[model samples]
Target: MLASLLDSMADSLVCSVELEKTKGITVRVYNESGKLTQTVILDGKSITIKSQGEQKSSTIIQKEDSIISEVKGSEQTSTITQKEDSVVIKCKSFQVDAETVSVKSSKDSTHESGGKLTVTSQKDMSLTSSAKAALKSTQAMDLETNANLTAKATQNVSLSGLNAELKGTTKASVASDTAVEVTGVKVDVKGKAQLTLEGAITSVGENITTVKGQLVKVEGALVKLG
Candidate 1:
């Protein structure tokens, strides 16, 4: 008895679909060229728009501003649509071959890719914002080139925060007639120390002691000479 009831319900569902097809709304348009010639409505959720020639039919979820959106089939193609305050765009593959391209988001925008992303410019590329802009990654940050990297400011340029570190194979140059100050609770130097200048130019204000492992070699005074 249960099997018979299930079979009857399946038949009813098939009949309802056939009735919907037969009783679908068809609107024929007169003097319509390069537009939808007929619009078929089976229910509120789906609609079909028919064109003239080889671009015959397309089933869309919504239609607005001469665009059919959320087309039903394998690989869909569509344009823009608006639902309330938000606007959306859908397509298979889009291409624009023009002289220039520009995209701006009023608020914040986000982009994610499972593959790779590449950006190339012929000349210079500058990024500026009124607020802060930050970029961070989980693994590592790499800077590779034989070129020079410079940071300059009108007032101050400082490498500060916890313990500052510098790792370079070449030499580090400092400006002439400028000050180089190193202050800490205990300054430790692991390698050999070398100091070279024109005359007696550096002032320590305290004492500078030179030690070799366990023995102290010399203790000297620093004279401030301008």
Candidate 2:
């Protein structure tokens, strides 16, 4: 019967996974006078549990051929994979020392954050972060794109461009349509500070094929003075 209709549609997507998806998961042990009794729930999925105080507990359930994701209220010693289309989540380590975070999507979606992710996208967005990263648009033809960035730490970075760049010191701020390049050097003149524009900037030792920052702003004369 065509393998019984593909095993009844894979057992209706693995029994529609429910059991309140394991509730109130926990782990805690303290004795530094920061008192708060013990609590633990290690292994409970598609849940059902009954444990109280002076904690120490364990439960297990496994069925191979893939499809597992239902862990709630903390303590997830990682491994989540869901397939009907594609989904794979593997974690050997994940810590959220949480404070506040949020996410939502209706159609197109791609979101990632190691410890911090806050997104409110109505249309287009590509945000990647290691720490300090910000992009805000109020929707009039909204376009924001960032392919890569890596920063170890050191503040004061802004790019509100018609174009902007510096792929080396890790700072790329662009408000695109024309020009923005750095590290290969070329940042088409605009109110200078550590500036660069490989063609002209005259006087103040004029060989400046374009390197300004002690004061530089070239727009139409393109700077020329030997």
lDDT of 2 by residue, 52-111 (tens): 223333322233444564333245444466656666766666556556657665666666
Task: List clashing residue pairs in candidate 2.
Answer: 159-173, 161-175, 194-213, 195-212
Report lDDT (CA) for all predictions.
0.55, 0.46
What does the lDDT come to for candidate 1?
A: 0.55
- On TM-score, the candidate that comes out on top is 1
Q: Looking at model 2, report the run of 10 residues with the lowest lDDT sum.
A: 13-22
lDDT for each residue of candidate 1 in 89-134, tens digit (9 for 90 to 100) = 7776657898988989898888876567666687777778788667
* Alpha carbon lDDT at 113, candidate 1: 65
- Top candidate (lDDT): 1
After superposing candidate 1, which stretches have Cα over 4 Å from the reference? 1-57, 61-68, 75-80, 83-85, 90-96, 112-116, 158-170, 176-178, 184-208, 211-226
